[model samples]
Target chain A: MTARFAVGDRVRVDDRTPPGHIRTPWYIRGKSGVVADMVGAFADPEDSARGGDGLPERPLYRVRFRQTVAWPDYAGDGRDTVDIEIFEHWLEPESG
Target chain B: MSTNVDDHDHDHARTFVPDEEDSLGQYAIVEMAVRELLIEKGVFSADEFRQGLEVFDKAGPHLGARAVARAWTDPAYKESLLSDGSAAVKEFGVDMNLTELYVVENTPRVHNVIVCTLCSCYPKPLLGAPPDWYKSRNYRSRMVREPRAVLAEFGTTLPDGVEVRVHDSTATMRYMVLPMRPEGTADLTREQLEALVNRDAMIGVTVVPAP
Candidate 1:
């Protein structure tokens, strides 16, 4: 399947906190970042955790966020960044 | 040789043969029973399990060191490694088919660090099991929040000008840091460079020391 988001596309992580195992970390929820790379498609880890077939794989992207933007109290250099591999379902196009 | 024989005799004299009844916990018993049931049901043979264990036993950080050393010596290999890490490692005969591998390079301007905040998902095929600190709740929680402080605890103090990029291995992708080759090592052979790469350096906990 083709990737929904291409590299350099600005996307925001969905803020919903659904129950069960999730790949997106709490710190990145609702944060916006540009897609660094499309890491290809894979089984949905959230479904796999519950013993499901995890079929119809979803594309995963490495989202890069500035450290200062992720954490208000980040003490490191402003240029520092954090990259998290997030499934396509957890991301949404950033709105103007 | 005489001392070895005496030690063997001393071990044989110990009569503390503990059976199932003498065990303090039932976890091992349950594990063995489940394993036997699985084997009997043809899920996997006992021999296959033993072979898997042997493969795991043979994998360690030394394999990752070899990959790093090769990348340092070969510019073309380093480019391929940075682009397709999983495939590049195959040149060194390391197979990591379970998950996609990404090689993040460390330069003079940027230093890379890796962590699994959700769980202890590591590049076991290349670097063996994750170190105790890598799997600890403290490291998982604090690394992304305060990386400089956490790295300092590991005795890695980066310069203020260097940008620290922390990669969280949250999905099926695993990361390995291709640390910068130390100074005064240009004359060293690949084998010599391999000796300098350690488990912590690949994990980004510490930098490779100059030889």
Candidate 2:
């Protein structure tokens, strides 16, 4: 699937409770952020159950998140930010 | 943080068994069985298996440090480093077919952190097999949730305004953080810089120069 976000575009990591054979990091689940970069697409490693020698390819995006936005009352300075590159399935358009 | 594994082990004495299970016992039971089965099936020779272990035992992080030092010394080479890591590493002569390298950078506003949610995906060709703590589930689970706490445990607390970027190395690409240089090391050579570069700096736990 094509990447739905672009550099500097705001997005949020969707908080989906997946079951069995999961890889999206727990800390990042439900965290909101902006797309900082678009790393090249690669074959989806999670869709191994499709029963094919090769899996469908999907794009991954590097999202930048401000720590203050993620963990409220985070005592450190608000300028602290984190950038994590996540696969397309983990992200979605921000609602508010 | 204290490298003393004992400091954190309050209840470890209750579970300690020094002579209980030797590596030979575990290897003899499980690894030997697997080796025997593979040999019986003619999958690989015993000699080949032993040779593989020999090669693995010889690998470590110094090679990666050499590459880092070389990059620091050469400007054009550092450019190559920022662009393509594996090719730049090749100039130092570290190569691997199965593993690809991604060099992450640390900035005043943005820090690069790394984790292996699946298994420890380390730069073995340079950094060697990941350390025992790195392979633990505690580090994998806690690092993302409380990076600052963990970094503090490693004796590295970021400045008030510095950003913290955590890179999870779970997929095809393995990552190593290229930490920013420290002050007071003005006339130091690349070798000196490499010495200042610790494994924790590469992991984003501690910065260079023992800070």
Best candidate (score: lDDT): 1
Docking class of 2: acceptable
| Per-residue lDDT over B159-207 for candidate 2, one digit per residue giving the tens place of the 0 to 100 score | 7777777777755566788877777766888778788777877778878
| iRMSD per prediction, in order | 0.5, 2.6
Model 1 clash pairs? Answer: none
TM-score of chain B of 2: 0.78
lDDT against the true structure, each candidate: 0.91, 0.73
* Candidate 1 lDDT by residue in tens digits, B143-206: 9989999999999999869999999999988899999999999999999999999999998889
Worst 10 residues of 2 chain B by lDDT: B14-23
lDDT by residue (A1-96, candidate 2, tens digit) is 566788888788878887654556666689889887676676665675355433556677767787777667665556666666678877788884
Q: Model 2: iRMSD?
A: 2.6
* Colliding residue pairs in candidate 2: B1-B154, B1-B155, B113-B165, B113-B167
* Candidate 2 off by > 4 Å: A1-4, A49-54, B1-28, B39-51, B96-99, B117-119
Q: Enumerate clash totals for all models, in the order shown.
A: 0, 4
By TM-score, the best candidate is: 1
